[model samples]
Target: MNASVLAHRSMLAKGASGAACLSFQLNEQTPAIFPMRQVQEVIVLPAQQITPIPNMPSCVLGLTTRRSRVMWLVDLAHMLLSQPLPSNIRNYNVVIIRVAQILQQQNMLVATAHKHVLLGLIVPTMKGVVRFSPDLIQTPKGHFAPGLAPCLRGCVLQQDEMLLVLDAEAIARSPILQSI
Candidate 1:
């Protein structure tokens, strides 16, 4: 876990209320949140930093070194929005996630043996941290984008706006990303 996020978690654990999460703008369009537990770090990565690989998933932006270890970067817009990201962008807003969710339907042994996976998600902008009760998350409406449905935990209303709460584990395990 990132120190900043750990601090945010601790602060919430003490006196603050609800689940702490970071809300980010997906392609500077739809709003979404990631539970703090899955977030390792949030960074601004220059376009030049990534080393492009051949014959990879379209969603994969490429690999970038983070803390001396190489991590694959995925364009969240390309994945969830099912749209091409603008090529004119100069930098990427990356949210590094460490996925180690236990598979509930799997046998206990296999679930227990699961290792943490690292991947960087690129978003257009971040909306800052927010706290919302788990019960507040609701099923997406019929009009919701199909591409984003599987990766979503649910939706929540924040200041009268619908904010999608994403499941990082599901995003990390996405089939398009799996091809990388």
Candidate 2:
């Protein structure tokens, strides 16, 4: 992980940056865009009862079933930034991703059903992917939701609009994750 971060930082230093268009919603508005490609698959998580962790935080929704395995379900918005989650999410997708390089370096077991490292977010839709450059992203400024400040990675400028980018790792490591 350390080497990867260093490599990413070095790449950024050498004018290397990429973006992934993540489709998210905050009510009736269209899916909000987020950039930083790492999403693998959009899956429908089972509606099984979750065993809540005692003394966990509010944003953490708890563990749920996905492909016969128990995976943590987290509040994407609250974890990323303080952006509120959609009021009604009939169903959400569990984005399964893996850091193969990191796993190899750390000697971590190649991700499998029994021993897996995954992060699941409750999203309204699976927005198509969009790619962008690092210089194209802008940092947020001025008054906004307090919780959102830390988790925001950057903002992507598309055509004539801006989309908030999120740090998946930050969200995964949030206090909210304690509940999952």
Candidate 3:
């Protein structure tokens, strides 16, 4: 297994904490992180599963089925940078995310409400998981692309590299997703 996977598994074994985060590259030059609490799973896109949706935003890649549930796939790079993944590229990596939690009430008439939605984010590469102390994360400063600032939680410096931590819930609730 890769170092990232090992790191991720080790963190999972350590139990839930804000210090654990999944790290992945948005592109060759950009690295980002997501709180592990929101990530459900990560997988490589199967060749035949991606069914492209027509007339949607360029970022909307399409939909795919995973474990009997339909997942909407969006290209994070395209959404943030307005640069879609190259057409010639075939393999894709996706991070499955659960946006929120559902509250269950036994006596209530409406026992089940659609509590949270699953979203699949297509990224150029998956870097595995990294564990950082909460204190390491610094408040976001400096300028960011207007499109990306809203979803960023903050940034952390790791091994001399800075990684932007993203809030998956914010991305899931973004107006861009609702507009489609």
Candidate 4:
């Protein structure tokens, strides 16, 4: 099958939450909702360990080691828009996402035997957890407010404000990230 088809089948789909909810606060305004199952973990890293990658874009915060794996943590505030990060930025959380794709070598697709599926992305501050409904999502259009559109899949309107659900894939491929 093709990549899109495989992605559709392999991508984490929302399942039953067992009555427990997952939640997070973005900009202290909206509560981002996500299924509990998809979350791998929420970690706090030392500020010094995050090495700066010279010549990298502003959004690329540099590499972070989690679970023995070096992950490139992207400042969601800088990755999304120019909003200020939470006061103890060193204690921020990184959201790691899983992606599956066959590697291409010299323009040819590598077979399954040589293909590799891996984790991508590191978003700061995972507030908590909340159940999300796919039907409630609505993708934004037209001129977006800065970096919001590229990373945001849509917004879930709440009694207080709008929760922005980020698209893991889009965030990984964002120009700001690839330039790193």
- Candidate 2: worst-modelled 10 consecutive residues by lDDT: 96-105
Clashes of 4: 6
Of candidate 3, the 10-residue stretch with the lowest lDDT total is 104-113
Q: What stretches of model 1 exceed 4 Å from their correct place? A: 1-16, 101-109, 112-114
TM-score of 2: 0.62
Candidate 4 pairs with clashing backbones: 22-129, 22-130, 23-128, 23-129, 23-130, 93-125
Q: Each model's RMSD to truth, in Å?
A: 7.3, 9.0, 7.2, 8.4
Order of the predicted models by TM-score, top scorer first? 1, 3, 4, 2
Q: lDDT tens string, model 1, 1-180?
A: 356655654554464788888999886558899999889999999999989998998888899998788889999888888876688888888999987745556445344436666799999888788886676677877575677888988887666577888988889888787677
What local lDDT score does residue 164 receive in model 3, on the 0 to 100 scale? 95
**Lowest lDDT 10-mer window, candidate 1?**
104-113
**lDDT score, candidate 3, position 63:** 91
lDDT of each: 0.81, 0.56, 0.80, 0.56
Model 3 misplaced regions, further than 4 Å: 1-18, 101-114
Please tell me which model should have the higher lDDT, number 2 or number 3: 3
Stretches of candidate 4 exceeding 4 Å from the true structure: 1-22, 34-38, 84-88, 105-124, 139-143
**Candidate 3 on 1-180: residue-level lDDT in tens?**
358744644564466444778899988888999989889999998746799989988899899998988989999988876767887667789999986643446765332335667899999889888877665668877888776888898987666578999999788877789765
Ordered list by lDDT, greatest first = 1, 3, 4, 2
Model 1: lDDT of residue 179: 73
lDDT of 4 by residue, 1-180 (tens): 356533432332344322223456545554564444445556666667787788777666677676677777666665666665654655556666544344668999755645323333344446555544465566643465577676666765433456666665565666676555
